[model samples]
Target: MSERKPVVLVTAADLAPEALALLGGYEIVYAGKTPSDDDIVSLCGQHDPAAIIVRYGKVGAAAMAAAPSLRVISKHGSGTDTIDKTAAAARGIAVRAAAGANAAAVAEHALALMLACAKSVPLLDARMRAGHWDKAVHKSLELHGRTVGLVGLGAIGLRFARMADAMGMNVLGFDPYAKELPSFVQRADLDTLWKQADVISLHCPLTEENRNLLDAKTLARCKRGVIVVNTARGGLIDEAALLEAVRGGQVRAAGLDSFAVEPMLAGHPFQKESGFILSPHIGGVTSDAYVNMGLAAARNVRGVIEAR
Candidate 1:
């Protein structure tokens, strides 16, 4: 008789059939809705699965503590902010993410936001739909001669820089960890970049040091009427400060995909702010990207279970 394959628990949303097929022989346990820490603990205790896969939801310490048999944690996406990595590391659980799986999608979304802001696409479309043709008030700016500053030159940032360069925009980047800038991009310190850039885009992760990195003081350094794009984490920019800047005309336009608070509140100032475009954290949410990440997570789970 064949031995039973190790069990695996998936605590994310509905799985695509392709993602499911990657599990092959494993005994799969699906937690359809968002699971609380206590629920996760109970599930792990009952299943004693070889691994647990999670998406945007939090997996707390209690859940990690209860899963004694867990050998790996496969994150469905790149961000591991919701997971307690320290606890998992202490327990000798291998944590893996599909880091580059959605890079291109996110980069393309960032460029789209930048172009929309530069061309005043949202405002023009709204006016046209309202039967008021206000072309003069919504005059678009040319991106060809503008300077773009990238705050973090990671995989997504570099990809965005390439797109911006191809659009005839000059690219400058700032990242303390980066050793060298690509030939097309100029390297600048944060303050210099703020002063010189007509458009500024953020592409950094959320960490204690970078939380609220774009506060009032730093924002004050930016060139007046600067366009801002944030496809990265929301906490990096101060929401209240951004609102103030927009109201005061310090910021000409803003494009944001993520927010300090997920599913931004109904009456948020940005919703009413003119020339601002907001997406519901869809920067890396292309169908192809989703399948790529899901398959990567499934394969990670299989690897852990089959290790000799």
Candidate 2:
């Protein structure tokens, strides 16, 4: 008798055929959009998936306990925050991330946001559409000959630093785990980076140690009228403090791709601010990035399953 193929539960159904081809030996199970807590648990119980690829849903202890055969959990992107590591560890399930798979896409998005905020793109578009030729504000700032500080010198941060350096901008990186500094980038302490940088960009993960790292106190340490960019995690900054800083003119502008809460409510205060440019967390969702991340995730699952 032939052995049955192992089942793999995938939350992202739209994965390219190239990615799916990597897991041809496995029986695929697709989960619908915006899967809730119960939905994930139910799928685990019903499908008994040997592995799961989490795209944008949360995976907690309950869902992990539901699948008796689950041996691996792979993230479709760099961030593994949505997975409960503690629970997975206790259950002897291996967890993996697709590092650098979409670094270029994320770095490009971060740079785009920074440029949009600096040039007042959102505000100008609104004014132009309202039949006003308002070129008198002159709020746009130049990127050349200015210093940009990067928090967490991971793959994404390093990519952004290289791009900024090529544009005649001084790049400073702050990452304790970084073994060596790359060329065209200088090392700076957090205090010095925040104070000296005319532009500050976050490419770090959200952990207990640095949650809300850019609160009121840190914002105050920045140079007056500093531009802030966050393409990492939303919990890294305190939204209330950011709003106050923008209103007080302490922060010249902010470009945010993530928020403290997802699907940022329409009634949010930032909706009215021209100094803040926001995106719907589409940093790593490019066509090329999706395929890269999906293939990486497939490889992780295959590695774990084969090793066992």
Candidate 3:
């Protein structure tokens, strides 16, 4: 009799064909889009997967406990915040991430957000659609020679720094754990960065220590009219505080790709604010990045399973 193939569960509706090919030997099971925690746990209990490739929804300790055979949890993208790392460690399950798989795509999105905020692209487009020509009264903020401050100089942050540097912007970065930075990037403390940066961008993972890093108090310290961009996690910012800052003109504009809540609730205050530009966390959703992340995740899964 033939033996059962080892099960590998993916926490999304689909993965790239190439990635699936790489794991041909394993039996793949997918949890549909918008999977709830309960769904993940149920799937784990049913599949008893040897590995899990997370693409959406949170993987809590409960799910980890459901699959005693689970050997690894590999993130489809860079951030592993969605996975409960502590619980995995306790159960002897390895946690890994496909780091830098979406770096280029996310960095480009950050740059687009910066430009959109600085030049009021969405606002201008709306005005044009309304048959109003404000070219005579409007002035766009030129990015050249401006200073851009970056938080979390990891892969995405470093890529953004390079783009900003190329545009003649002075790049100041704050990442305590970063080492061997490029000559174009000047390392600075948070206080200095807040005071001097004309533009601020976030590219760090979310952690308990840094939740609400850009709250009312911190936002108040930044240069008035500073443009803010976040392509990272949404919990890093205080949403209500950001809305108030925009309303009060303390922050000229904010470009946010991630929100504190997924698919932000209807009639959120930011929805009414003209100074805010938002995307549905699609910074890393490009076709190229999708394939890259999926492939990396599959390879990571294979590496762990084969080694054992």
User: lDDT: which is higher, 1 or 2?
Assistant: 2
Provide the lowest-lDDT 10-residue window in model 1: 31-40
lDDT (tens digit, per residue) of candidate 2 on 1-308: 98999999987566667779999999998888677768888999999899999996788899899998999999999998889999999999999999999999999999999898888888888888998887775658999999999998999999999999999999988999998878898999999998999999999988989999999999999999999999999999999999999999999999999999887888899989877999989999999998999999999999999884
Check candidate 1 and list the clashing pairs. Answer: none
Tens-place lDDT digits, model 3, residues 1-308: 99999999999999999999999999999999889889999999999999999998989899999999999999999999999999999999999999999999999999999999999999999999999999899999999999999999999999999999999999999998999999999999999999999999999999999999999999999999999999999999999899899999999999999999997899888888899999999999999999999999999999999994
TM-score of 2: 0.97
Give the per-residue lDDT digits (tens) of candidate 1, residues 166-229. Answer: 9889999999898877899999998899899999999887888989988899889999999999
After aligning candidate 3 to the native by TM-score, how far in Å is the CA of 226 from where it should be? Answer: 0.4
Each model's lDDT: 0.86, 0.92, 0.96
* Number of the candidate with higher TM-score, 1 or 3: 3
RMSD score of candidate 2 (Å)? 1.2
Count of residue pairs whose backbone atoms collide, per candidate: 0, 0, 0
> Each prediction's TM-score against the native?
0.92, 0.97, 0.99
TM-score of 1: 0.92
